[model samples]
Target chain A: MNENRKHDSNAQDRTDRDWDLLYEIRQRVIQSVAKNMDLFGVTPSVGRLYGTMYFHGQPMTLDEMRDELGMSKTSMSTGVRSLQEIHMVYQTWKKGVRKDLYQAEEDWYKTFIELFTTKWRKAIEINSKEVSNAKGLLEHLWQNTHDENLKRIVAEDLEKLQHASEYYDWLSRLVESFETGEIFKFIPKKSEA
Target chain B: MNENRKHDSNAQDRTDRDWDLLYEIRQRVIQSVAKNMDLFGVTPSVGRLYGTMYFHGQPMTLDEMRDELGMSKTSMSTGVRSLQEIHMVYQTWKKGVRKDLYQAEEDWYKTFIELFTTKWRKAIEINSKEVSNAKGLLEHLWQNTHDENLKRIVAEDLEKLQHASEYYDWLSRLVESFETGEIFKFIPKKSEA
Candidate 1:
């Protein structure tokens, strides 16, 4: 009976070690994803929550996530909500469960398209408006100025603004295409056998 | 003669007003560009220098840029050098001028391609390496573990890392296509008569 007990303890020790290793791996991946998300203007907590849900591969409740991630309930709720708004996470229903369960989308391509299109489209729209304003100001200055050097300078700058405006307009459309998956249509796919 | 002098003075005042308006416009554009560059992890000074040179539409000496932009000689030199390294700015020689003159590339398409390819490729490369490391650790755990729960969890997480690594690899290739202008070939052009 003592030998059996010793064998059971050894198995439990091994299980603990395995859990430790898995936890270490999960932490590293979460950190990496969080760092990358920082580049895209996302908070580290949001990335961490998403990464956790992704690897968990099962719908998790807010309390479960909060406990597992050692985050406050408020933080977990906010992060999960933000992820849901971005379509990175979604709600899942479990039979006989009243609380909502959330799971990571796991579709990286769709997630990227949604994230970048929203970001780039907004950026392009802002820039386009600024370019237009600058162009208007320059044109007004050009018309009112009489000096040859100043006229030439204003003309050149106005041209640059117009060029930039056009490019941003084009970029906005490109981002729209990205959203619609039309941009991918341009990419060549391998021929099927 | 007194009346003529008054007229000349009035003309000078108008020129000054025009210059003031142009300067204000330039400042606005520079600020906008600097803010956008911040998103890409570039310093504000670099974006300002690029905007100034782009609007100037002429090769400018470092001293000239420093004096006009109210920046220190050291900052001007460093900003210009960084811009040159990225191929956004290039040195040009003027006849009878001994000092090197720098000018903005002014080709927005080329500039975007060069800047984004360099930044995104580095990001993808780093993420790919991290994903591979995570995958290795997970595979190691999977092999060493006998518990079915741990095995299933590691297998699922391993699949995620593999998927992410593949996506990053594909994105790196897409950036290469952008560098080669092969991606542009896929873009539909305006019909020519």
Candidate 2:
């Protein structure tokens, strides 16, 4: 249990209250991260495990995670898989280690680019397809109709659909820029962040 | 039912099948919108109502919306209020109009800026505050501790918190730029979306 004894040159002596203070400090961030995980469509418990792993700053196995979080091993496994799927955590092969290990992705910007670009691209594809279909129907309706009133109404709707298609096209480009990291050229992630 | 007859110069003579065709066309967009509305954290039905109103391209009363969606009036009212809260729809007044009219906010870019900036800012504020508090506690512990191992651990944690704080600051600036439309200058929302 005493990792300090194994590696440290000096004998360690941290009081219970000192450990409590350290726990309290990280608790704030862990809670905050858990709350914000909702933004990424994850439950708070899964987010909490990620936050705990982030603070650990070490590769962890499912058993280690379960021991630390007091969650069931099954739950820990599911949580880690979910986090990995969202680009928040990754499974790693540790040298000389038999059990598979997992690590948290510390770079938030990289995670955002990877995750959001995929989601945005999917949404853009779905919406653009719908717009195209609607445009085809409206255009056909507009051309075939002998009635001027029907033509006018269909034409108006067609124009709106055209605008929506254009928007979807632009959004597709934006999604590409994100995936390519070209957006950083415009937003400039050069500073401390 | 025959507003076109009252307004148009000629009498209308369109079959029921023409109306069915038009409905089919709008159905695609309405379904697409309903699916995407999950991004804004609304139910599909509410999003469907917004999409229907968007295609209508005019201010409509609650009763009119209920009739169009075939939803109960109470459900319509709730959906309208939820849409208004998210800046997806707005209450508009017509000259001497008795019943209040609600219109969809068709500009998606404006809606994105308004909604996301507020949510991002709140997240930035919360995470930054937590980082500040953690930094304060760690710094104090590091200074007081004679144990080099404890100090080293706290120092490492402190460094992480500092980077996190900087990220939050940069994110805050990004949120403000979005709110002020300053980001558009760099990304250039010029072409379409």
Candidate 3:
């Protein structure tokens, strides 16, 4: 009976140690993701919370995440909201539970599309507007200018703006393709290549 | 003779107006670029300097650029140095002139490859290191833990890390293909499509 008890205690001790190691590993992953997200100008907490959920491989409660990550409740709420906004995380309802549970979107391809389109499309929109603004001003100048050399330069500038506009349009189409999963058609498969 | 003199004066006035209009357009383009650069976490001055050089479509000396863009010599110098470091601008030596002249790279494809690879590769390098670090810690945990459930969880985490590492490697290869212009092969030609 004493031997059985000793074996049971040893098994319990091993389980405890395993839990400690798992927690340590999760923390390390969270820190790494937080650092990378900061480089991309994203708030670190968003990455940390997402990383924690991803490593846990299960839906986690906000309070669980807050305590595990040592983050304030407000920060946890804000981070989870932003992650959900970006489609990187989603809330899941548990039966008989009032608090919402969240999990990271584990598919990297979906995450890539979300992030790429969000950033590049915004950049394209801003740049396209600016290009049009500059083009308008230059076209007005081109119409009124009488100096031959200045007319030539203005023409060149207008052409550059046109080129930029065309590229932005093409990029917008590409982004649309990504959103629709049509981009996979263009990406040559190794078998076909 | 009096009529000839009047005609010359009128032409000079037109030239002055053209110069004024050109300066205005240049300023607008510079402002647009600076705004976009700020969005990408780059300094406004760097974008301003590059935009000025690109729109000018010719090599410009530091003093000339400073006068045209209304930038301080210090800002121009620093901005130009940074642009050159990124391979977006190149210095040219003018005959019978001591001041260094610089021009923006005219080829968008070359510029795109240089900029995209530089930024993305640096990001990949940093993220890859962090992923590896996380993987290392998890591997150590997996080796030490005797709990079957904990070992299974650790194995899954390790697989995720391996997948991330592989993706980063594939991205680095993609960057290299971009550098080598091999990416063009994958891009569907409109004519063929």
Candidate 2, residues B125-165, lDDT tens digits: the string is 88788889888888898887776766777888988887787
Ranking by DockQ: 2, 1, 3
With candidate 3 superimposed using the best TM-score fit, by how many Å does residue B129's alpha carbon deviate from the native?
5.1
DockQ of each candidate relative to the true complex: 0.47, 0.47, 0.40
Best lDDT among the predictions, by candidate number: 1
Model 1: residues >4 Å from true position, as ranges?
A43-46, A61-67, A70-86, A90-102, A188-193, B43-46, B61-66, B71-87, B90-102, B188-193
TM-score of chain B of 1: 0.84
Best by TM-score: 2
Candidate 3 per-residue lDDT, tens place, B1-193, comes to 6999999999899889778877777777668766666434468778888888888888999898899778898888888898888788999987998888999877655665677778777878877887898788888888887788888988998998887777676667767767776656654222132
Question: Each candidate's chain A: what TM-score?
Answer: 0.84, 0.83, 0.82
The residue pairs that clash in candidate 1, if any, are none
Residue range with the least summed lDDT across 10 consecutive positions in model 2 chain A: A7-16
Per-candidate Cα lDDT values, in order, are 0.82, 0.81, 0.78
Alpha-carbon RMSD to native, per candidate: 3.5, 5.5, 4.1
- Per-residue lDDT, model 1, residue A42, is 71
- lDDT string for model 2 (A74-121, tens) is 999899999999889998887899987999998887776777676677
Residue B115 CA error for candidate 3 (Å)? 2.3
